[model samples]
Target: MQPVHIILLIVAYFSVLLFISYLTGKSANNKTFFKANNSSPWYLVAFGMIGASLSGVTFISVPGWVESQSMSYMQMVLGYIVGYAVIGLVLLPLYYRLNLTSIYTYLQDRFGNYSYKTGASFFLLSRTIGAAFRLFLVANVLQLLLFDAYGIPFWVTVSITILLIWLYTFKGGIKTIVWTDTLQTLFMLIAVGVCIYTISTEMQITNIFSYVAESELSKTFFFDDVKTGDYFWKRFLAGAFVAIVMTGLDQDMMQKNLTCKNLKDAQKNMFWFTIVLVIVNFFFLALGVLLTDYAQKNGIDAHKDQLFPIIATKGSLGLATAIFFLLGLIAAAYSSADSALTSLTTSFSIDILEIDKKKNPEEQEKTRKKIHILFSFVLIATILVFKYFIADQSVIAKIFTFAGYTYGPLLGLYAFGLFTKLQVKDKAVPFICIIAPVLTFLTNYSTIQYFNFDFEFFVLVINGVYSFLGLFLFKK
Candidate 1:
């Protein structure tokens, strides 16, 4: 496809999103933006969340990850099922009982003002960097495939990308995202389905079972190596905690769940979302096998993160496959990005600014609008900064590693709050949270250097344990 055609495809896609925003943003207020007035359909939210949960990182990186890790990522996917169940059974009821606009507010009610700010600040730091990384992947791809053809700088491309997200989500917020995300999820799934079918036809695999039987990359279990990243128990446990911290504890994710009408609806959403997410992830791994096979047979020299894009855009995947890839990539990227932007806006406005206590309704809305735009620029800056420092590693792996450090404090804080009734010296909460990640990092480094034991996602567990201990020691 020509660069102009790709540009047109993106323009048409955003037009549809803007229309959804216009419809949803009508008469939207702080309630609608933050909570969607508790009116989102449970099923729509569930379906939409698959895309938001996967994001562009998964859409692009997970398939490529299969080359190195094979189907071992499924270990984490299975763990997510357990994590989501815990969220529905434990966390959802608490949030609903509290009638929370921001899930982090639970920290305040359970601990104190300092703990509340600490939790929300961690979320802001974690999601800001995480979301920026995801968007950076998509923006970098666009820069490579389209903008470089026109000599556009990376920062310009990133700014344009963030600006478009702000335009659609600036008014309706979560209200718009519930609907837009559903549409984007549909496109993402269709793109994956079509790519799978097209590749199967190209490979001349008449039987699906036969294809799996022939491929070595389809192997899923990895119990043999306790020291490696692919250990089944290690991956499974890490996956469970990751889902707990990244989705259940995350404001970016739980904001959609909060939009559902009640706890029952939110729980229903989590159940079905978990099921679909597992199935979709399985297909992504399958696609990875196909892409890697296609690359080897065709003598395409690409590995890790470069595998999928190299074949889709540069190799002989055909024009239709290219179009679907572009569509799927954008759909997946924006579905997550749009919601992250809204949730960041929601968190900062309510948690950090205390817009409710500090301002009248009219002023609260005004302040929210300003914060929403501010975060868009924040996202752009973070993405540009990432461009300077990020090295050639699996983006998905980097995201998870980064999460282990950033979200571990959150996991510990929440676990301590829910499982124990002890109140910490509230003023010390922020210090404990800050110290936890640094200590976790130093422990990881020392263990890797001396013990030759590389902790994968389990680093999150370590971080959480450290934070929990810190909180316990500081208890009043």
Candidate 2:
């Protein structure tokens, strides 16, 4: 495909998103932006979340991950099922009961003003970096495949990418995202399904069962090595906690759940979302096996995160496959990125700035608009930083590792709040949250150096434990 054709496709895609935004953003106010007026359908929110949860990182990186980890990522996927169940049963009811616009507000009700600010600050730091990283992946890909051909700069590519998201989401916020994400998720899944069918046909394997049975790379269980990162127990436990922190505790994710009409509907959304997420993830792993097998048989040099793009775009999979790959990549990338932008706007406006309390409704909306645009620029700057510093590691691994440090504090804070009645010296909460990650980092370094033990995602668990203990010691 020519660069012009690809550009045209992208233009058409954004046109649809803008139209959806126009419809959803009509008469949108603070309520619509923050909570979607608590009017979204349960099923729509559930279906749309599939794309947000997977994002571009999974769409591009998961298949590539198969080359190194095989189907072991499935261990985490299985763990997510249990984690989602916990969220629906435990966290959702609490949030609904409180009628919270921001989940971190729970920290305030449980502890004090300092704890509330601490939790929201952690989310801002974590989601800012995390969302930037996710957008960076897709922006880098766009620069490589399209902009470089047109002699455009990487910064320009990123600016355009972030601008498109802001265009759709700046008005309706979560309300627009509820509908836009559903559309993007559909595109993403269609792209994956088409790519899988194309590859299967090329390999002359009509039966997916036969293909899976024959491939060595399809191995899913990994109980043999307790010391390695892919150990089933480690991956499973880490996966469960990851879901709890990243989804249950995350504002970007939980915001969508909050948009549902009520607790019962939200729980229903979580139930169905978990089942579909598991099935979708299984297909991604299956696609990874196929990609790795194809690469090996054809002597493609690419491995890790490079495998999917290399095969889909440059391989002999044909033009249709390439087209779908582009669509899927954009859909998956923006699906999450759009929501991240909104959630960051929500957290900063409501939590950090206390915009709701500090301003009249008109002024709050004005302040939120500015913050939304500010974070969009922040995302662009962060992506540029990643371009300079991020080396050849898998983007997905980098994301998870970063989450281990950033989100671990959140996990600890929430755990302490929910599981215990002891109240900490409110002023000390921020220091504890900051110290937890730094201590977790030092512990991770020492253990790796002396014990030769890799904590991987379990580092999150350690960070949470340290934070929990810190709070316990500081109890008033």
Candidate 3:
């Protein structure tokens, strides 16, 4: 755990990434920069997507979650499968049929310019915040590794780290992201696997199936009698909504999916993606259960998120295991950090700013580079602002929760356009979309406070309903 070792590991990782970036960026023109010339293999996109889907927030959060609530999150993972199915069958085809450069363009065609901008704006705001929060999670870990371990200043650590992501992704955009993300996913899965092995070995639970089954944490699904608060139905609904909004409806996630050669491949990729997600999440939760049991037995004190890292860094793990664990963590963060950067730029360019129509490929490429730089700065600012002003550890989570309000509108608007023939007034669409989420939040808040109603995982459901109602009210 020497500071220099951590620095060297980071440098080595960046050096290789830089080499990859230079190699890829060399031939990058507008098409290749934006969509990898639509030449990426669907399977590669699917594998690369794991890094994007899980990110640093998920990498740390999922494992940490196992230390509490008795490893209950597995209940939601089952629901996630159902959600992905809906996305593949219902959502992906719609996106592909439209042949969209930015999916929000569908809103414009279905409704009007106002609706398109509203949807794109919501995406911009939601994605900007979401990406910032995800990156902040990674930044926090890097800061600890730097200051607590190596005494580097927080600002310097944040700057240097983000700069590296910018350097690599500033040129090739989503094309480079597809390949880099695959690399990241490989690193990420390897990291998760190493943790599973280390924790199981330390517990002397040699048989993977028996260890997971015998351990109290191995309960993968829930059938709670209660109607809410992690109940089976609630968790399932929550998982479905999470998958739909976080994956299907999200540009950041779907942008990679859309890079496939054709919609058939994209659909195939989604199916395989869902299957892989299920297996991967199962392992994370199982690891959580194992880690929790081991800690309880060994009298270890650590936060739920810190539980895995602490054990791997300080526990009975051998040197090689420890190194792999660290590398995995770094890999997960970098994998996500780069994709977020790419997606933010893509959304901004296609959805809001209209970089797709620049006409001249050369100018389009230069404009993209400028936008990438702009977003990198915005992300750095977000991390700094959150670090200094936000005292609550829950603030970041709340930002995500609040940011989620926007997705309800996205879900409702998209569902309305695809499922029904009702025409909406172009001018009023944006207002309806905005008001829907606000009303949903108010209703949700009031229900929880006055009626003794607790909608733990169904917030997005409520959000969709409110948005739908608003659309109905404002329809032409």
What is the lDDT of every predicted structure here?
A: 0.93, 0.93, 0.77
**Model 3 spans > 4 angstroms off:** 225-227, 388-400
Per candidate, the number of residue pairs that clash is 0, 0, 2
Estimate candidate 1's alpha-carbon lDDT, on a 0 to 1 scale: 0.93
In the order shown, the candidates' Cα RMSDs to the true structure are 0.9, 0.9, 2.1
Enumerate residue pairs that collide in model 1: none
> TM-score for every candidate vs. truth?
0.99, 0.99, 0.94
What TM-score should be assigned to candidate 3? 0.94
Query: How displaced is residue 209 in candidate 3, in Å?
Result: 2.6
What is the C-alpha lDDT profile of model 2 across 324-401, one tens digit per residue?
Answer: 999999999999999999999999999999898964789989999999999999999999999899888789888889
List where candidate 1 sits over 4 angstroms from the true fold.
Answer: none
Worst 10 residues of 1 by lDDT: 205-214
Taking the tens digit of each residue's C-alpha lDDT, what string does model 3 give over 257-365?
7788888999999989888988888777777777777777888886656777677776777766667777777777777778778877877787787877777877776
Q: Which tens-of-lDDT digit does each residue in 1-476 have in candidate 1? A: 68998999999999999999999999999999999999999999999999999999999999999888888999999999999999999999999999999999999988999999999999999999899989999998899899999999999999999999999998899999999999999999999998988888888978856686578988898988687878899899999999999999999999999999999999999999999999999999989999989898999999887787778888776999999999999999999999999999999999999997864789999999999989998999899999999899888999999999999999999999999988899999899998999999999899888987778888999999999999999998
Instruction: Judge candidate 1 at residue 90 and give its lDDT.
Output: 97
Quote the positional error of residue 66 for candidate 1 in Å: 1.0
